[model samples]
Structure formats: C-alpha cells, structure tokens
Target: MGFDLVSRVRLYKVLERIGCSPKQFDGSPSTPSETNRGVKQGCVQASNLFGIYFAAMLRHAFGGFREVCGDFRLNISLKKTNIMGINTQHPPNIHISNYQLEAVNEFTYLGSVVTNDLSLDTEIDRTGSASATFAELAKRVWENTKLTLTTKILVYKVSILSTLLYGCATWNLYSRQKKRLNIYNLRNQWKMLKIKWYDHITNNEALQQTSIPSIYTLLCQQCLRWLGHVCRMEDGRIPKDLLHGELNQGSRPRG
Candidate 1:
C-alpha cells in the first residue's frame, strides 16, 4: 500500500534510526602533492538503504517495515517495488524474505530519468522534446496578429524557454549538445519571428532583434547562479557540504 502522511513519518523515523543517509560523491583533489586530502578518490560510503553492500541490512529493515505495515493493516505490494542499478556492470540479485526484487536499468524519480550509466543524454532528449511540444502548443500565440512582438517574446520566454531550461543548472553539456540545443532554440525564435528557413538573417542579428541572449549563455548564467546559491548555503546542507568537501585528490581537470 502507498504510504500515508502518518505512515511516511513513521517510515522516516525508522530510516533515520537505521542510519540511512543521502548519496555522496568523493571527488578527486586538486593538487597531486597534497597528501592530506581528507576523503580519497574512489572511496564511497553507502549511506543509501538500497545500496548493494547493505542488502542484508535493507532486508532486515524491510522486515521491520513489514511488521509495522501488518500492525497498521496495510498491504505491501512487492510487485511494484523495483531496484535500479547505476553504472553497474552486472545486475544485483537481491531478495526480501521469499520475494526476489526485480532490477531495472533506468527509472524516473522526481520527474528526472536516472539511468545505469548516469548519463544526461536521455534526460536532454526528453527535455528537448517536451520543450518543443510546449512551443508547438503555443504556436497560435506566436502567430497571433493582435499581440505585439515584445508580448510574444515574453510568452515564449515564460512558457517555452522555461520548459527548455528546467533543471539545466545541473547539466554538464558537451559542446555538440550545447550547439544542438542552441540551434533548436534559434529555430524556435525564428519561427516566432516568422522568419523563413532560407532567411539570410544571422543568429546574432536574430538574437539582437529578439533582445534575448543565446540559449547557451542563458544556461551558463543559470548554472553560475545556482553555484553561487549552493556556495552560500549554510553548513550541514548536502549541497553545501558537497561543494566544500575535501575529497579531490589530484590536479583538477583542465577545461
């Protein structure tokens, strides 16, 4: 059965008592000579309940949870429960009681697609497609004769661009992907301006006419702003801790 508010609270308490923690990354350090880097590279702590190393612990926790559910007269749907592996070469075989859990290569969590390889290609494609769909849905607004160009631009930014750039602050886009997304953004802007494919106008000129920055520039700005915000977060917060963690062990990557 799905967890109600009270059940969720109880579950949270149990999880906390069992020492469950959030996922963490131990990044490489900057200087090769710095021997005192606290957390070493490739060192990981499996704080997640679903970690493979903690399968036995998870099974025990699940048993406890099952007992709790029984007391509340709630039915647990074993078939609906799934385990997903990230960057795993082989699928893990795990069981709780007599039921074997199924493993999946990818799953959607919090509206984001998480895959075994942890690559963003699928996510980018999905976001791009969704953005295009939203833009197409707003085609009538783009083509409306009564609306001013400024108003249409506002609508495009608020509706289309916002959708396109959702969660972009966390993206680490390659040059080719950035180029492709920028081209798509430019095409949409051209469509809104009623410019033909054969139009001799340059991208810079089009951007100037629209009075909007390029998609790449916008993404960079958003990422920088998000970094600033994370840096300013108070200590003990996960994002802040990750940002300031002393895990890097070698020379930083040269961009």
Candidate 2:
C-alpha cells in the first residue's frame, strides 16, 4: 500500500540483483568461467561448446585415453582406428597419435555391409546367391513332378528362403523393401508353378496355388520366435541386454 506498482517492480529487480551477485558485497573476487577452448569434454558438456572447438575436445579426449593406455602399458593400433559418421553429410576427420584414421562410407563386419545409410538394397544384393541356390536344385527338386507342391515349398523354405533371408528376423524393413521381398517371393513361387506374367494369373491366385504365406508373415513369425529366444536367454547375454537394457543417455534437447 505504501509503494506504487512501478516502485514495487523496481524494488524486486534491486533485490534480485543483490541476491544474484552476493560476491560484489562479500569482498570476494568472482572466478572467470572456463571457455570451450582446450576444455575436457568428459567433465564439461559438449552441447555448450561451439563446433570450431570440437577438435580441441577430440584432442583432449584422445590425449586422456592415450595417457590411460600408457599407464596400463597397452598399445593402440592406429591402423585399426577408423572413423565413420552415420547419416551425416560431413564426417569428422579424426586423428589418433597424429595418424589420421581412415574415414569409410561402409565397412564389412562379419560379412554384412554396414553402410552409412543402412540401405536394405545392399542386403538384397546378397540374395543373388540364394537365387543361384534355388536354381541349382531345379532339375531334382523344383522341376520334379514326383515331388508334391508342399514338399517343393518346404524345400524352398529350407534351401532358398533361408539363404535369402538369413538375418531377416532383425530386419527393420521399409515399405519399399517389404514390397520388394513380397515380389521376390511371389515371382519365385510363379517360377516354381511355371506360371508366366502372360498366364492371366493374379498374385493372390498364385499365393493360393502355392498355399504359402507372404514373406512379411514369415518375417513376423521369425521375429516372434527370435523374441521368444531372447526372452529365454540369460540376463547377461548380448541379445537379451540389447533387447532389455536401459540407455545411460537421453535424447538431445529440442531446438
């Protein structure tokens, strides 16, 4: 009641200033903040740093890691240290022990081509071998009138499809990829039935003729089976850990 609205606002601002900078009245000198320059990123958050200072952060981390390795008397092979940035246009040029590591767009790990874009087409290329496998036994199995369609289908499942979709249980397929797989399955079925495109047979008719499920259905079945296996696996198993483990870090802050 004693002060106007303007006076009250001014008073609040003055109190806030006094509360925030207590060191001004306490006779203690304020310490200067450490900039991103030559800063250790492990202790400091990288989000606060500018992009130009990122090299310093890398250098700091590399130096610290090398020091730790030196203390442990462990050798790091510079040739084995390769840098790859996924889904990025500009990859970072990384140097370890002053030797620049090779930057790769894709690399093979255990026979799988792990590309930067995670393209399913690369995986599809491996299906050529499955095609070859399917055709290899055409004279004895697929073409044999003595074999029932069911038997042929079973043989296709065990021989051809197995080779085609070796790691399909863990597949994260796009609509296009799913369609391609379906087409591949249907085309192979038509070939087994000796039905051509000009035979006036619909894809569904062909499916009914073979009494076979879609490739997507097979994928779902395999995925469910894999899920069951993962569920039964020991807690320390890698697959179990991958399925059930909680991440230490969270998503980046919204812009």
Candidate 3:
C-alpha cells in the first residue's frame, strides 16, 4: 500500500531487462561486462530477446576478465549458469565460446524463486512453509511459562518472521498473495499462542495480545524503506534505474 507511488511489477520487470554491452559496461572494447556486484560471475539481465546479439554479448563479456594484478582467468561453471525466457514461449539456445547454457523455466536466486511467469506465489508459499517449520521447531519456547509473552514475540520475529520476509521488499504482491501470507502468519501465531479454533479468539484479538502488525503492514514498511534507499542512489545506478527507467525500444513477447 505504501508503494502507491511506484509500481512494483514495473520495477521488477525492468530489473530483469536492465543490462549493457561489454564495451559500454567496462569502458573498454575487450573487457568483459561488469555486473552490479562485480563478482566474477553475476547476473546479467538483458532487455531484449535471447538470440544472436545476446550470445555475442555474452562471449565478449566473458573474455579478457582477470585479476587486476595477476593473470588469473575466470572460468564460468556452465552447471551453475542457467538461461530462461521471461515471457516468450521459445527462447533460442545461447552459445558462449562453444558452451551452451542450460535453459530453465525458473531458478532460485538469492534464496528466492524466480520464474518466467513473473509471479511471487512459489516464493511466498515456500517461505510460509519455512516459517511454519521454524515455529514448530520452537514449540518448547512457545509453551514456556517462565518466558514472558514479549520474549516469545521477539523470538517469533527473529526466527520465523525473518525467514518469511526475506527479500519481501522487492515483491509484487496482489490481493490473493497478500491474503495467503497473512493466513500463514496468523496460523503460526495461533500455534505459538496455544489458541485452538474452539477457543473462539478473534484474529484481531490474538494480534492485539502479541502486539504484532499484520503481514501486509510489515511488507509495506519494508517496501517503503527500500524505496527510500533507492531514492538516494546516484545517477546510472542499476537499482535506481530499475525503479524509474524504461526500455528504449521493443516489447517483451507475449506468452
């Protein structure tokens, strides 16, 4: 809700579309293209279809990269490098220096699921399960009478909510997804607080006892906080551009 000023869907799409040619990237014709993290192998998000130019760019970008003070060369692990088509049904096989990268429908990046469908359902579902596991594993702590309710709530936040909200700031949440997450959070709370369905404790009353805001509010705060960080970025920064930039030409193919 707090992200009314910026479209999370648009921003996420652009993040996958942002990239540059090798020459434009490192300011040298022979140098490999550098990514935001500057790692030897990092994600490169192309703005166009995966085809000839994209393959060529990858080849050029993978060469001439080495340690600054040594002759060490970087060898990319083809097993780890995967390519996928975002909206297109058929993406061509991309060959880089005689090695063809594998194509996938989805992949896990930084502990989150990324799919061609551009949806967060899988990630959210997985996180919900993980949070439930976390809560169940701490059953003893939840039932400890020696521990105050405040202490239990703090543990819940640290152990379960932390896992559930990982990378949530960048999520594009719809009403259905939001409701699903809230249901998971509420169920976890019920178990932790030893509230049975027959107890007839309203969800609001349970929340009031724990003094925890709804998952929707927590998500909004996270998104707004990240937006503030992006707003302060200098020009030509990828995160800032991903938030405000648009493709110069060509639209993504229909699925």
Q: Which candidate gets the maximum lDDT versus the true structure?
A: 2
Instruction: Evaluate residue 5 in candidate 3 and report its C-alpha lDDT on the 0 to 100 scale.
Output: 23
* TM-score, structure 3 vs. true: 0.66
Please list the residue runs of candidate 3 whose C-alpha ends up more than 4 Å from where it truly belongs after superposition. Answer: 1-72, 96-98, 246-255
> Per-residue lDDT for 170-244 in model 2, tens only?
777888888888888898999899997788999889989888888888889989999999999888999999888
lDDT tens readout by residue for model 1, 1-255: 223212333443456666754233555433434233332334463224223323333455645766755554345577777787777788988776788888888777756777888887777776566566655756478778888899988887887777677788988888888887888889888887888868888889899989989988999999999999998888899998877777458776664
Q: Please give the CA lDDT of all the candidate structures.
A: 0.70, 0.71, 0.71
The CA lDDT at 69 in model 3 is 9
Most accurate candidate by TM-score: 1
Model 3: lDDT to the true structure? 0.71
The alpha-carbon lDDT assigned to residue 51 of candidate 2 equals 27
Candidate 2 vs 3: which has more TM-score: 3
lDDT of 3 by residue, 33-117 (tens): 4334321323353223223233333445544422210121223555677788999879659875677878888888768899988
Q: Against the true structure, what is each candidate's TM-score?
A: 0.68, 0.56, 0.66
After superposition, which runs of candidate 2 have C-alpha atoms over 4 Å from their true positions? 1-83, 92-101, 135-141, 144-151, 198-200, 236-238, 241-255
